[model samples]
Target: MSKDSIINNLFRVASNMFTQFNTEEPLISEKTKVILKTTEGRKELYKKIISNPIPF
Candidate 1:
């Protein structure tokens, strides 16, 4: 798959997981804004992807 498709899939899955388990956290959209704005946040996001890889 292409990079945009992969990122969209990540966002979709993250939204679903957030909805199922947590109601008190910030929306994924807001988090997405920050991740897009910061190098550090992007690095952390990469760590998350690396640690909890998707099965495909």
Candidate 2:
């Protein structure tokens, strides 16, 4: 392959790697972080759900 084609391929690979890295990150909100941080928060969330809940 030509030098120009090799450079273009490298740029393409770099762009794909960046996109994958960006999307792999979890998007957590502040409220979600709080809920996951303590047992009380988790219990409060658990209380809101019914044991025999039907699927929507």
Candidate 3:
């Protein structure tokens, strides 16, 4: 899958998990926004992906 597809799938799963758990944390939304950010946040995500090396 492409990176965008992976990210979208991740958001979908996270949303489902939150609903299942009845979580009302604002931090989750805030973190999602940060992940979607256009600048430094994107760089941070890139760094994390490079370091972790997701196995497909």
Clashes of each: 0, 0, 0
Provide TM-scores for the models: 0.46, 0.38, 0.53
* Span of 10 residues, lowest total lDDT, candidate 2: 2-11
lDDT of 3 by residue, 2-56 (tens): 6555565766786677677754564367766767655566556656776998688
lDDT, candidate 2, 1-56, per-residue tens: 65444444644575566656555554545676566456666555445543555698
Q: Candidate 1, after superposition: displacement of residue 41 in Å?
A: 12
Report each candidate's C-alpha RMSD, comma-separated, in the order given.
4.8, 18.7, 3.7
Q: What are the lDDT figures for the candidates, one per model?
A: 0.67, 0.55, 0.64
Order of models, best lDDT first: 1, 3, 2
* Pairs of colliding residues, candidate 1: none
Worst window of 10 by summed lDDT in candidate 3 = 19-28
**Which candidate model has the greater lDDT, 2 or 3?**
3
The regions of model 1 sitting more than 4 angstroms off are 27-56
Candidate 1 residue lDDT tens string, 1-56: 75445555776787787778765766666758767457566566666777997899
Candidate 2 residues lying further than 4 Å off, grouped into runs, are: 1-26, 51-56
